[model samples]
Target: MSAQKRLVWPDVAKGISILGVVLLHIGIGVPEGESTWLYQLNTWLDPLRMPLFFVVSGYFSTKVLQFTLRDVLVKRVWFFLVPYIIWVSIELWTKNLEWQWVFGNEPLTWRELGLNLVLGHNMGWFLHALIMFNLALVAVRKLHPALAMLLSFTPILLLPLNEHIFFIGKALMYLPLFFAGVYFRQAITAFVDAVCRLNVPALMFAVITYAVGFFSRDLWNQFTGEVVLPWYLPGMDYMGSQEVLLLVRFVEQTFQLPMALVMAVAIARIPYVSSFFAFIGRNTLPVYLGHPIALTVGYHYVQIVGQWEISMDGERLVNTTWFWTFVCIILSGAGGLMLWSISKVPGIGWTVYPPSLRQLQEMVMRPPVLRSEPCRD
Candidate 1:
């Protein structure tokens, strides 16, 4: 398959996973196991979203195989960095008013602020470490294929051995996985194609994942106080933070990646569902940026109306956590899509710009109809 064609599942998966990622952060509680089994689904899903995102991202970057050091840095740095910095800067400007009390840390001075604006911090670390991975790859871009593969994982492996630069660690840490996606781009594509061919199996996998995720949440809650899953979000704990050991991460990542891929592929197979979800997938950046704005504004309004009680876990405000959870998903997706579309115009692009090529291309380039499912991954 062509390099461009090799990415369909991952692209779709990327959109799906981001939603999962945002939901985890937005939801106060893990939907592990409540009285009903439904919540465990996200638990199962929760693990996979971020890893596949990184892998698919890695898979595609490696697939393009067209990047130069300069080309890689400019786009990777600017594309991710620019928005991350700008958004976090906005968060800082806004005092991250919602989360300020939730996660208070050292304040940024003018100099410190400017430095981090460049260096990136907190949730913005994805861009910072990603830039590192891209720049590191520049050295091997022209090297023999085998050598490049070996080199990619170097940064990822060295991560566990370090105690500092936790933010920078993910760069090299996931590089191998990224390159692995690229390397096995063919294999992954083939596997996905095969999975797509077996509709029953794919759907079964999706349903089972949903159940698995739901159950796991129950399992985790039953044991979280003692289980020490240890992979808590960065800075959320006092152990100063450390990357998950490689082997454990491998076990955990496999479940989530496959869960995400199967879900994306299964969704792609359906018509009405595919179109609606794919629209969300393609316009991912907007949903990512704008939803928080909505969440922030809405959270404040809740307080003013004397309804100041919004549970991150929806159990308190609604009939059930599931109801509000779905609401969060829809609002996040719509908020992102609307804001992204608005940002596409010249002046407003900075707020929630579409990825330039596809958004423009999609306007004129019709999304092909999937007849009996396309063969590419």
Candidate 2:
């Protein structure tokens, strides 16, 4: 397959994953209940969503990962860092603005924003994590590929550390899957293609296994009496019983990877589905960076009315999960378009593509080196 054709599925995967992210954020502060199917759906997708994105990102970073430290810093680290710094600042500013104007909540101080930018403390942490993962992989780049992969498990096994170091914690949590993508690219590609062919059984197995894992997770929580920690968002804190969380994490991770790949391939094989998602995938950067701002604006506007749901024909369905789901879809689509439009404007476009002249000069001046093999420890 041509290089461009090869990327269609990964892009499709990214498109879907990003959309999932938007949907989750759009529902923020909406109360969760058993009947909230959208909430349930988001819960179900939580595990697979980011792991898939990281893996796909890792797949594409193979050559860059092999670059020398300088090239890696310029090409990969700087690439993610520029936008991360810019957008995190914008996102924090928007949040403070909204809180000050509408919610009467204490706004984050500039010091807080500065600290968050350093610590990867916002929704933009994906970009933040990318910088670290690229650098982290550098140390093991020349280890026997298998040994390096085995070491990737180190982070997941030391999962307890996530509590004390939440910023590095999040990056470490996803690093193994990212490493899998880098080290096992060929095997993963073959698997995706094979599932695309045997899509029916593949999908069924994927769904069944995922369902089993999902439900069993709830059961495990019930069994263990797992409680949400104070500092973490629902379903995100790693401060629970270490032994049980490890088992839970392992099962979830194992099931999540296959399910993610299957879902992407399944979507890619459909007639119109593949192309549509691929288009979204191709244009994900704008949506990823802009959707939070868009959603934040929409959210506060809704808060002014003191209602989280919409009115249709003079009827308010405040508790209708489907209504919220529909609204999220509409907002996500509109937000994406709005961001895309804003990106076309001059000068202001730096919010999305904020690279310094020095960085640009470095990129242009640097010559590509043969893939470096770091000295093995």
Candidate 2 lDDT score at position 171: 51
Q: How close is candidate 1 to the true structure, as a TM-score?
A: 0.68
> lDDT score, residue 230, model 2?
41
Worst 10 residues of 2 by lDDT: 229-238
List model 2 lDDT by residue over 1-377, tens digit each: 34554677898889888887887776664343324666568777788888888899889878965688887887677767877787768878887887777768787887888888887778788888888888878878878888887887666545455565566456555777788889889978877766766757666777787877677677777765555434233434445565446557556755667888887876877888899998888877778877777666665556556655442222557655556556666766787787677667877766665566586689899998899898998
Winning model by TM-score: 2
Looking at model 1, which ten-residue stretch has the lowest summed lDDT?
29-38
lDDT of 2: 0.73
TM-score per prediction, in order, is 0.68, 0.79
Off by over 4 Å in 2: 1-5, 31-34, 101-104, 156-161, 199-219, 224-239, 242-247, 305-325, 354-359, 362-377
Q: Write the per-residue lDDT of candidate 1 for residues 233-347, one digit (tens) a residue.
A: 3443422223434333444455445566776776776767666666656766666666665555554334334443333355455544455556666666666766776776786
